[model samples]
Target: MSEMVIETSNLTRRYGKKISVNNLNLHVPKGSIFGFLGPNGAGKTTTIRMLLGLIRPTSGQIRIFNQTLPKHRMQILRRTGSLVESPSYYGHLSGYENLDVIARLLKVPSKRIDEVLGIVRLTSAAKQSVKGYSLGMKQRLGIAAALLGNPDLLILDEPTNGLDPAGIHEIRALIKELPAQYGITVVVSSHLLGEIDQMATHVGIIERGHLLFQDAIEKLREQNSPKLLLQVDKPLEAKRLLQRAGLQVSMDGDILQMPNQGLAATEDVNRRLIQAGISVYRITEQSRSLEDIFLDFVDKEGSL
Candidate 1:
């Protein structure tokens, strides 16, 4: 069995009458990019804070690196790196200088500074002042700082927030490579389902302080069964024929809709329709997008 780098059970956090996070359980496997997803005010940040031991949970437990949190906070933090929301950078200092300051504070060797800069592809901009850096550069610099400690797990909260399309893509690519290239487990929080679909190996979705889904990205894709749409000479006859053939069928106006069982089933359907003298005008296979699945889960749960 694969090791779980981060795990939480019934984790809850409340601000007086307002419950921020309600009974959340997260399982992040080692060396996998785990995308933490939720809408605004979905308690993602609160959960992250609790994980870092910056705040105490209202109830439940947290474990990281196979040890319980708060009790092992110092030990866990030594092997974890994080960048939450916006990163603070000194405007007057050059990028290299900023990292040097952090290295000195963390007692990290000076050589590790250059190595991290290269990892984030910021070596070229190392001498450039942070004030002149683009938003993407600044974000990458923050990640480089996070990597300074050579942590086993990396946590990032909306690392691409407030960036343009190109910046978002750059950060996304960097994040996708971290687990494979650097052997680090990552927990990235984002509200954008499309972005998460591209890079995350696993995902956990939260809405209105409630967890809606948590599983591998492929498992989530499996939930969205493909459908076949047929335009035939007689929609009613086609629907009835498919139903009699032990296939679930539905009519949408002049078209017949059925589950896309695969090539053999499609061939069977075509053969049966042709035998019935029904001309098949067109057949289209439609697969649901991740956005569709996300919306369905959120809507079904009524987590506005």
Candidate 2:
């Protein structure tokens, strides 16, 4: 197992009688882009706040950088940087000036501000007032500010919310580069499955304050294995022939469906079917989509 930069055990939080976060365990491996995914009001923000020490967990333990939170809050924070929702910035301040304010607070050298500006590709707009900047530019500036501290971990909550396609692409590209270019571990939260699918190496899914899945993105994909699909003549005959020949096959209208055997096996099956006078029009593989898998988890867990 890789080193867990952020590990939680039975972490839970409540607001009055409503439980915002049920018992949860999250493992974020170092140097991995961890996608924190959940629906709105699913306790994603609450979990982030607890991880950042912005709010205390009702019960459970949080360990970041191998140090327990709150006890080492300042120390953990010093090596951690975060941007939750829209970044807080002075509109009147120039991009550089805004970063400088945060830099001063972190006691980071002035040159580090320039470095982060370059990292976020905001150096060209360094002197521009943030009020005049585009939404994407402001997001980049927020990321620059986060990078100013040169922290090992960066957590973002809905960082791409309310952005145009180009803007979203820009942020996604920048985030995808952080791990390899700067050795930064990122914990980015999003409700969009496609966004997480495109960027994250690992994923944690939550719904109604309950975490449904946590593992490498590939593992989630493995849950929905592809099935062989075929459109052929006399589907009933094809199904009967394949099944008798030791291949499990079913019919969906005029098409035949079965588990996707390997290329050679499929080829052998195809040859046998052709010999049996069943014309094969089209052969393809179909699998349940991630959205399908996600919905399955939500539905099944909700009922439980």
What TM-score would each prediction reach against the true structure?
Answer: 0.97, 0.96
Residue clash pairs of candidate 1: none
How far in Å is the alpha carbon of 222 misplaced in model 1?
A: 0.6
lDDT per prediction? 0.93, 0.93
RMSD after CA superposition, every candidate: 1.2, 1.4
Off by over 4 Å in 2: none
User: Can you tell me which runs of candidate 1 are displaced by over 4 Å?
Assistant: none
Best by lDDT: 1
Which one is best on TM-score? 1
What value does the lDDT take at residue 174 in candidate 1?
94
Distance (Å) between predicted and true CA of 52, model 1? 0.9
Could you give candidate 1's per-residue lDDT for residues 256-278 as a string of tens digits? 88899999999999999999999
